[model samples]
Target: MAKALHPTQVIVRPLITEKAARLAEENKYAFQVHPDADKTQIKDAVEKVFGVKVVKVNVINLQRKARRTRTGHILHGQRWKKAIVTLAEGHKIELFEGV
Candidate 1:
């Protein structure tokens, strides 16, 4: 069984990239999400926080990246999950409108 998650914890933040912005036009919005969150949890979180009806949720697990700073310092990025949330055909998430 999946553990319950607060709406805020489930959705870490909205993803703002050129690719994600384009997808938003088609009623699909992307977000950085909790690593342990599943599709169901993501869908519910989006709906509860955005006041929009979610039709589908697709998840992608991201691998940590290895980075080397100019000073030769090694920095390891944390692993996280990304969720693509598709809203109902006629509905939209207003938060992305002005962005």
Candidate 2:
């Protein structure tokens, strides 16, 4: 069985990007979550950390991609998971407010 994860451990960091900023306008925020964390865990973590009601949670498994270096060496990118969290109406996370 997998060990339980704390709120901080579940949510790695907020994904601050152009696309993410656009989604924030729609009451949606993206976060880089632990690979082992599920949608329910992500939902709980966001709500607990941000003190906001979560309307929905969506997760994406971003597979590692191959990259070629200048020396003709092949490398693979790190595999990570992303979570898109939609907050309830009238609620928003303060961290994303200034972005």
Candidates in order have lDDT scores of: 0.91, 0.93
Model 1 error, position 85 (Å) = 0.3
| Candidate 2 CA-lDDT value | 0.93
Worst 10 residues of 1 by lDDT: 90-99
Expressed as tens digits, the lDDT of each residue in 1-99 for candidate 2 is 445899999999999999999999999999999999988888989889889999999999999999999999999999999999999999988888778
List candidate 1 segments past 4 Å from native: 70-73
Global Cα lDDT for candidate 1: 0.91
Q: Could you give candidate 1's per-residue lDDT for residues 1-99 as a string of tens digits?
A: 777889899999999898998999999999999988889999988988989999999999999999999999999999999999999978998878866
TM-score of each: 0.90, 0.93
Best by TM-score: 2
Instruction: Tell me how far the alpha carbon of residue 32 in candidate 2 is from the true structure, in angstroms, after superposition.
Output: 0.4
